[model samples]
Target: MVFRPPFEEFEIQLVEVPAGETVPAPTNPGPLLLLVTRGAGSAAASGGAAASSKLLAQAELRRGSVAFVPAGTTIKYTASGAGDLQVWAAAVNAKVFAPATAEEAAAAAEPALVAA
Candidate 1:
């Protein structure tokens, strides 16, 4: 958002990937900002779509670690320890980026613009 609401784009989503569980995160709409806020975990990205995805890269994620997943990539997250793995996703032009109300535009613009 412009300091006064100009270019309102992108979304912020919080997700918790618990231990003993693996979840697929498909980021096809736009680039992703993966920030591990709490707990420890790991994420892996592949080369192809589901069922045939080849491992492209992997990362050991912990507190203060950040991952930049490109627009057309898929990443899997699994909590490593007892605590749940919490992630803050800031995706540009995806998720809750659509702002129908004037107020939403203001709130939405701040993060998107600042992130950019």
Candidate 2:
């Protein structure tokens, strides 16, 4: 499926991931702004561990906090502590750059894919 931004300026998706769940990775091309509203989670890029890196700009985000993530950066998130992992994912797209296909996104997200 194509990941088309919902809004004209940016798309805001209020996502809720259950406990012990982790978001795999993006399957399209777009900048993501993840605003944590409740619970705890860890974000890691392709060459990092989900719980070992502090790359993602974090915030208390209990009520109001936000973090901006650039495009082409593959990220994996694992929820910690209690409560549901709630995040507001803002997707932005520029006309100059087209979205990546599912295959491309998968290849980019994987860390050990041998180049052919």
Candidate 3:
């Protein structure tokens, strides 16, 4: 689904990871909020020059667990236990809500994925 706010646009995606599977880290140019819909898992995020991956957080992921990932951060997701992990992700454009100076607008339009 799609959500169009006055200042930003967000896309909702359903992500599923089978048990014992690890998904590669993904970097977003904006912020993202993930709500767990089923199962359990752990997320690891890292940013800045140090660049070392650390446990961002873990959740039982029943029905109300939510995870927030800041802009420009790299996050890796791993599914735990025998049940599949399902998450509803809402990704928002940071620039839309927090625009930079006029000169930076052009550059901010492009999205960059930082390596984890």
**Stretches of model 1 off by over 4 angstroms after superposition:** 1-8, 48-56, 95-116
TM-score per prediction, in order, is: 0.64, 0.56, 0.61
Clashes (N, CA, C under 3 Å) per candidate: 2, 0, 0
Report the lDDT tens digits of candidate 2 across residue range 82-112. 7777777777644336578899789879988
Ordered from best to worst TM-score, the candidate numbers read: 1, 3, 2
Candidate 3 wrong stretches, greater than 4 Å: 1-8, 48-62, 93-116
For residue 76, model 2's alpha carbon misses the true position, in angstroms, by 1.6
Predicted structure with the largest lDDT when compared to the true one: 1
Task: For candidate 3, give the lDDT of residue 80.
Answer: 84
Pairing residues by index, what is the TM-score of model 2?
Answer: 0.56
Scored by TM-score, the top model is 1
lDDT of 2 at 107: 87
- Flag the better candidate by TM-score, 1 or 2: 1
Q: Candidate 3, residues 73-111: lDDT per residue as tens digits?
A: 766667886788777778874346564787787776767
Q: How close is candidate 3 to the true structure, as a TM-score?
A: 0.61
lDDT of 3 at 62: 53
